[model samples]
Target: MQAKLRMVDAIIEVHDARVPLTGRNAYFEQNLLADTSKPHILVFNKSDLIDKKYRQPVENEMKSKDKKVHSIMWTDFKHKPMVAAADLIDIVKDSVTNMQRYNRDYRTEYNAMVIGIPNVGKSSLINAVRNRVLGKKGKATRVGDRPGVTMAVLNRITVHENPKIFLIDTPGILAPKAENIENAMKLALCQTVLETTLSESLIADYLLYYLNKRQLFEYVTEFQLKSPTDDIYELLFHIAKSRRLINKSDKDCKPNFSAAANFFIACFRSGRLKSDRFMDFDLLNKS
Candidate 1:
């Protein structure tokens, strides 16, 4: 990635909007952003999953925290009309043009490198911008629901024709530095890390703890619970029995708690537990 950085004109760092505070890659800060002249844009993807009301506040907080971020964008790659993608094109153009391009100022075309931790929509952003600018029908890069989809740095993809814009897609690079355990769990909760890296029950327990701490009990109604409970096993058992996820091999036909945990995690990921408006780092400063 450092080798490819020299050839690119700008940087687009994608992150999960739900985990804006903890989803960022520390490697980028220590390595990629070493050059202050580079135009770096921080894109908070999956913004649709979070409440829209917090958008401005989050932006303000990010700007105050990281002045190196030349621009900040909120995007949902799958959102129709794709206004964010198009607007991103404009921002990139202005950012690269206004900033010092090092030795590439004479170049007519713009090359931006899309980077982030796994599954934060780096490829999706590339595909969306490519489709929007070029009016292309298919994806310029591969996209998936899970992490580690793009395993390596890919060739430059053209997005626009005039002042021609191109995007370079890179594998999601996680920071190797040790992080706060709670913040790391937040990353897992937002699905930035692979699901298999942590046990489903463990992640589910953290989710329950987080939600309960926030006093957000919408999951109770979503899962048909009479009331909110602090116990992860009890919740999983209730969901398992309700959904009839049984251990058929067992003589007593016990509820499949593992399967139920997986289902619970899925519901949280899809934002079903919070009426499609969950934010992972809400009141982070206060907490």
Candidate 2:
């Protein structure tokens, strides 16, 4: 990743607006951005999932830290492609203008690198910018709902002409170990890391813990439960029964806890419940 940093003019760090300051790879500062004195802009994608009231605070809290965040913007790439594209270009231009150009000083064309954790809409955002800014109308890169979609770093692809802008899309990078268990669970819950990293039951347990702890209990009505409960087993059982997913063996019938848990987690992941919700950011809160 450090080797590639030299090839680009600026870096665009795309993170989920839902989990703005959590589960982000800590190495970005010490390695990529620090070693290379270039413009770095932070963009929060999936902005529609978060309430507008929280947007400024998220940026403010992040900026309060010691690290210099050139600029931050809230973007919903899918719905408002043109608006997001324009905002992205404007920020990049502003960042590049103020920073030392280094090797890129004499270059006529501009190259921007996109990096972030998995499934945070990196490829999708690239495509959105390309389609809108260049008047092109198709995906320049593959996009998926799951992690590791872009498994390797890619070469530069033209996003615009005239000033001639290109973007290099890199695979999502994650830390080897989380700062703590809650962060590890938050990353898994947000699907930034692989689902296989943790058991389905365990992720479901954390999901219930977070929702109930935060007092977001729409899940109760969603699962047809009388009230919220921390016991994941009890919750999944009711969810399975309510959804009519039952398993029967001879004379015995039982609720499918695995299926129910999978469904519950999938709902949260897919934003069926308006819940790509952020964790309570401890560092941001302290700042």
Best by lDDT: 1
| Regions of candidate 1 where Cα sits further than 4 Å from its true position | 275-283
Q: Can you write out model 1's per-residue Cα lDDT over 12-114, one digit (the tens) per residue?
A: 9998888887777778888888865688899988888888877787788888878888888888887742687888999998987677766776788888999
User: Model 2 over residues 19-129: C-alpha lDDT tens digits?
Assistant: 877846788887787766677788898888767878777877888773667778889987887899888987876676667776667888888899998999999989988
C-alpha TM-score for every candidate: 0.94, 0.92
Clashes of each: 0, 0
Say which candidate scores most in TM-score: 1
Instruction: Tell how far residue 37 is off in model 2, in angstroms.
Output: 2.9
Cα lDDT of candidate 2 equals 0.82
Q: Which ranges of candidate 2 are over 4 A from the true structure? A: 248-251, 274-276, 281-284
lDDT of 2 at 244: 73
lDDT of 1: 0.83
The TM-score, computed over Cα atoms with residue i paired to residue i, of candidate 2 is 0.92
Clashing pairs in 2: none
